[model samples]
Target chain A: MNDPIEILLVEDNSSDAKLTIRALKEKNLCNNLVHLTDGVQALDFLFGRGTYADRQIENKPKIILLDLNMPKVGGLEVLKEIRSDHKTQFIPVVVMTSSREERDIIESYKLGVNSYIVKPVGFDNFFKAVSELGLYWLLLNQPPKL
Target chain B: METLSIEHSISPNFTKKDIEILKMYFELSKKYNPVISEALTADLADHPLWGPLMKQQTPEQRKAQNERSLAMQHAAIYEGKWEEYSKDLLAQGVMYAQMNISYSDWYELIKMYKDYLLPYIKKDFADSAEKAILYLEGLSKFIDFAMYGIAEAYFAEKNRLIQANEERFRAIFYNSMDHMTLIDRNARIILVNRIPSHYNKADVIGKSILGFQTAENVETVKKAVHSVFEQKESSVFDTAHLAGENKLYYSSSISPIYSENGEVNAAVIISRDLSLQKEAEEEVKELNRSLEIKVEERTKELRDVVKELESFSYSISHDLRSPLRAINGFTHILKDSYADGNEEALDAMDEIINNTQRMGHLIDDLLEFSRLGRAELKKVTVDMRVLVETVIQELTRVPSERKIDITLQQMEKVTGDQNLLKQVLVNIIDNALKYTSKKEHTLIEIGSYADGGNIICYVKDNGAGFDMAYYGKLFGVFQRLHSASEYEGTGVGLALVQKIITKHSGKVWAEGRVGMGATFYFSLPKPRK
Candidate 1:
């Protein structure tokens, strides 16, 4: 857990979160991954607030996989907070959610999201999408140094 | 013999010598006045001018006229009141003229009196011939003076009548409501009824009308004026003037004024102000523009609401699929991890997986059905025959040993969205194939014909037909007459076909009888020639 977090997954549904994590683990990209259930916990972990206060704030994740629909603070608001701050603006934020609504896609891109993906209904397609996105963000895409 | 001058003058002057002779004649005429008056009054009854008039009078009227005649003669000769006698004669002349008496008739009556008096003058002075001539000349001069007085009265009365008529025309010319101007062929203002508020009467009287007109209207006004003069006809035109900040409109009508001998002279132009009407028309235009803007705004609002509803349905389906995916994924893992060698657990897991898959298919169909409503239609002329054949070829591409027969009748071309029309044909013919699969020999016929302004196409199949009692629910969303176990269907095929057809301004209907057969009909608008 102390090794620098490489992937940050933000999802409101627990089952969806577990499935996404499992897919990443199958690809062996889940070694340094952190899963937050909602947008509030994701924001707290990123800014080192609340239960994450004692953690090192300078330790940044390689990519943040965000979901759009969440309770008590949504993913778009979290993305807005992340992109607006100079300290975390360089983090690559990938929006992966079940919503194929055009508004959500446009808003996420307008907030400077690195990539957007619509989670497929079939488990095979969903597993493949998550695994490829994790492998690309963690292995292929070069993130700016914080 | 001294002859008197008989000049037709309104006012005649007499010499002193004529007065002396008239004095001598007056003394001689005094003795014979009674005889002359009586004889003249009796002769007046048969006179051409006075005969009918005197005949209608009573004897008392004749007696009064005789007495009046004697009194007038006595006033002239014996009393020497010639001034009074001349005044009375002149007054009577004016009265007669006012009563419409012909001047010839009045002159003839005067001559009758002179003829009667001449004989008496000659009889009184028969011994001295020179004296008789002198007295006769004086009497003639006296009668000429009296006639001169009557003639003067006639001319004065005529002049007064002409003056009255001139006054009447002047009143009308000066007191008109419209701005009436008299212009010559050169478009110069000769006379105007009302002067413009900005110009003096003196300044406008002789000025060229083009000077007063605005630049835009000068040519039009000049042309109208010249046309009226040349064509000898009236012309009307419109003109606009910018009066400071306000724009004034006027309509001028120019009519030719003919002079004597039928020559076109000056033209009179009457200009009426039309600014108020122009302003009213502008206001109506502004109102229409605002109304159009309001209608456009309302249409935009309605479009936004429709867009919102579409996105709402799209997101709901997507969200629903998310949970189903998780359930399927978790169940697959559970069956592999914990249900090994356990028949009951494996069967339950398989059931869960199958139902979840089914639900996923339903949601996908529902989303697609909703998307059809918002898709922009791309209309083109589509050949129905080619489209049906292609659909049939594709549906029957999979080789099977079962005997299958498909008959495609003649179909005319129609105008619609090509892809949507293809979708409609595929759905209907596929239903035919699916329902008729249970039969040993499958018979599916697709045909079309021109029905009024539309091309009606129908698919007939000898397959599992539904009861006619549920015909009302044929094209409704998710309304299926058959059980899913008997026929694997999402029940959205017919509804999708209905939506597409309705969007093309067409209709969809079906007829069926249980165990007999079923026919599905759809109509599309004919392409414009």
Candidate 2:
């Protein structure tokens, strides 16, 4: 309970996942980084089900970095679920994806996403984008009290 | 008067003794009248006036009636009163006509009587030769006078029959429903049946049939009429006549009328109106033509939509995904090859990352461009000045090192989708900012002017302008004249701007010169009531 998750990264691609983790680590903002490969697992963790049943539901992540193009239970659907439930609705969710699709951006915001960031192609810009998002969401962004 | 005197002088000369002889001849004629009458019928059976009636009469009765009439004529002729005798002869002529007897039959009866009486008279006056000769001459003259009367009555009966036939034929010609006309050999209209409502009968009668037709049709009708007369053959043709505002189509049939000597003297033309039939045929043809055009237009629209869908799929599968793979592949290689980072390797990795970012922007722009096709326009009366100010604020938020001065002018309120029009302003303003970054003092102007019923809003910038020659490619997807090194763009900004404007039922255009400046303009419809 004392070691509540700081960041929950839901991404399908392994390489993108690694790059994002490295960017956060370089910025010294990688404390208790929870990485889920698919949206289904990410939902399981958020609701404390399946493998994360033992974890308390009240101990929520500070920020959820969700990816849009995923194999199971895409990011938009996950965001919708998070907003509908009273327990998880207040949690800060940042939609991070390779898709700069306006549909995803507009829809994510409509579903109560705190931030929306497109992952840059170059490693440098990619690192900068993730680092800045990590610092802002973890430190500067004020989340509503659960 | 002269004919009367000659007729009087020619009367039979008879003395007092001759009269007695004539009376004796009359008594004897009565006995032989039947023989005379039988001989007359037999001799003149082929006469037109009596030919039909003679077949109906018995020879015995005919001879008896003829003998009495002959006896009367002899008695009347010798009475020495010419007027009274002439009257009796006329009465006899009328009786012959009433009985349908022919003139030739009556004349034959008198000749038979003369033949029978001549020997009796000659025997009685044998010693007096002059007296016998004079009586015979006088008898011959009386027979001639009787023939004149009978001939007049025969002609009067024949004329009555001819007049009846003429009336019946005239009724049929004048009462016909069709436009019947009689034309002379010179093609002049001699008579018309019922004239059409459009013309006077008198006007049409003396005119040629060709006069009422168009110039082209006149030649055709002329040829038809000519053939009917020259070859004495019937001719038929179609003709269109314009009477007032109405056009009448007719099928004309012309046939020649021959004279007694077998020469073509005139022609009869009968025309029937075909306007209703022609109108229906033309209407059907027009309907078929329109149906064909509609089918062709629908097919063309379907083909265009299919082509657009194919290109959209290609952009999604190939154009967007290719760069993503490169970024992913290169990043993996960089981490593996250089666990400890080197300057050159890091730079190479940075270049890969930059290209990946450009590709991401390109995908975003392409998605927007495609979405415009599907988006339903939600129209509102948008204030152009407010929209321009908001877009300019968004563009300048990137924190550029150079100073930019943006001027806003009074803009007309226009009708458009609020969000879509905002996107158009954002793209154009951002372009103005980016191109003017090299200038010492960047200046951007936003304004609108009236052009017909539309508001032509324009954004002008003092920037690195494009060549006028390549202006055509300015609004095309990924078509940029400037190299990637010279300007940082995915070359989709202007294309996206054009799409948004076009979706709002607006038009976009630009004017620029190399190293000078560019002015981008878009026209939107004025707000409606």
Candidate 3:
């Protein structure tokens, strides 16, 4: 719990989560990364509530890779909670999902999401997209001190 | 004088000298009455003014009328019945006037009667010149009295006719349903027929027209009245007035009434009430307003339905594709991890991957078809010849040893959404290319022609054609006439073509015979000039 969180991968589908983790691990950006299956666990980890009450809320992740469709709590509501709170508001949130819907993209931006990416169907394309996103956000992107 | 003196005479004011002169002339007139009457009748028949009237009478009727005239004259002087004679003369004058005889014509006829008597009186008094002159003067005075009576009666009859005409116009002026008033140049109401229900006749007759008008309409009425007088032309306007508890609308027409000297002395203002018409107009407006609201409500409901459909398709695009992605992703992983050197397992995993990829394509195509239903058409002139060439170029770009020939003929331009029209061409041409793949020489012909109000384009192929029996299912969604082994298709190409063409207010149909050939035709409205 004291390890500085590098990436927070919030996705419900296990195969998608495994593939995303593998893609990032190949790029060597998966260290200190934490994976949450649903938006409730994601929110709990971000705000130090419920199952993650012992975790420090100030020790926020460098980036949060969010999926729109999830169980218990949806991605947009989790984003709203993350953005509304001053402790987790500055953390970069990139919506990575299978939805190419205009409304989903618009809603992500409207809720102050840093970036939106539609997961590709082909394994090669999806691997490359995840690798590029991990390198850009975790390695290259400049973040404010949180 | 003693013979002329009479008791109970009608003219008791006649002097003894006047009686002597009248008695002498009456004696001479009685003796020569027959001769004088004949000459008078002949003179009237020849007189230019009376010739037409005298000729209308028979000779016997003229003779009897002349004798009756002499008898009446004889009774007036000899019988001293001047009152009766004057009354008869007045009645005759009225009768002549009614016959349209002019006053000058009557005066000329009287002169002829006196002229005929002068010669007779001269011949009878040949020795006494003084006595003859005196009788002639007295006869002149008697004729003058008769003239006065006839002229008075003629004028009285003319006055009666004028009064009758005035009465008729007065009846129309007062009995009319409209509010009629005559106003002078100063806008003072001089005369009004049928006073308004809101005012007394006395209040309206001599009051300024501005006083009766409401504050808002005073200027309008004043301007109309002023224009009629100043321009000497009629003017009209609409005005509203408050009468008791009700407001009334009126359309007033003010016309100049010209005097005899052609001057505009007054204006006749006729106002017709338009409150009922205005009320009907308001009711119609209210009805239209309610109808507009109903249309707006229906439109909002339809918009909500379209929004729901959009969200449904969005969910399908997202939720359906996620699982397919997982399946395709894990299958590749399994083929890489466990299927090493096992061709059967690797082949089975490839099959699974292929099917998952195919499912993704199906979801995309389905979402696209649904999107076409909601997309707004951006209409422009689409050149079909260039569009078909472009679609053919794209569909045939895949490298293959199979020889394909596409013959594109002259195409008429049509008005439609350009991108949608391109999709239509791509689908039909792609189908043509696919169906003709088995032929030794694949031949596809694309052509268009004008048909009445539409431009019909057709794609012809010479390859594996379908039986006409299944024509009804040709363009239906997922309804394929050929098996996957014969041809590879998701069966949504022609359905997409139909949807696009239908959106452009066009029609699509296909014709084919087994083992022969097939032709797909689509019609679009011609571009407006």
lDDT of each: 0.82, 0.77, 0.84
Docking class of 2: incorrect
For candidate 2, give the lDDT of residue B2. Answer: 8
Q: Which candidate do you rate higher for lDDT, 2 or 3? A: 3
Per-residue lDDT of model 2, residues B217-293, tens digit only: 98888888889889888988988888988778889899988898999889998988788768889999999999999
Query: Per-prediction DockQ, in order?
Result: 0.37, 0.12, 0.56
Q: What tens-digit string does per-residue lDDT give for candidate 2 at A69-134? A: 777798899999999999998888888776655556788888888888876555656778889989
| Evaluation by DockQ, superior candidate among 1 and 2 | 1
Residue-wise C-alpha lDDT for candidate 3, range B1-529, written one tens digit per residue: 0011112223335666776777776667667767766667676676676777778988788668767777777776667767766776677666666676889877877677777787777777799889889988777766676777777776776666667779998998988888888999999999988776778878788899888778989988888887898899898888777788887889989999999899998999998889877889999999999999999999999999988887788789888888888988888888888897899998898889888887888888888888887789999988888888788778878899999888888899999999999999888888888888889999988899999999999999998999999999999998899997689888888899999999988999888899888999999999999
Off by over 4 Å in 3: A12-15, A22-28, A36-62, A69-93, A103-115, A121-128, A135-146, B1-177, B182-242, B249-267, B330-352, B408-413, B449-454, B525-529
Q: Give fnat (model 3).
A: 0.76
Provide the TM-score for each candidate, comma-separated.
0.58, 0.45, 0.67
Error of 2 at A116 (Å): 5.4
Question: Which of 2 and 3 is the better model by TM-score?
Answer: 3
Instruction: Specify the poorest-scoring 10-residue window by lDDT in model 3 chain B.
Output: B1-10
Please tell me how candidate 3 rates in CAPRI terms: medium
Q: What is the lDDT of residue B463 in candidate 2?
A: 94
Measured on C-alpha atoms, candidate 2 has an lDDT of 0.77
> Residue B18 of candidate 2: its Cα lDDT?
57
- The complex in candidate 1 yields a DockQ of 0.37
User: In model 1, where do residues sit more than 4 Å from their true spots?
Assistant: A1-6, A36-95, A101-117, A128-146, B1-267, B340-346, B389-412, B440-443, B447-453, B527-529
Error of 1 at B79 (Å): 48
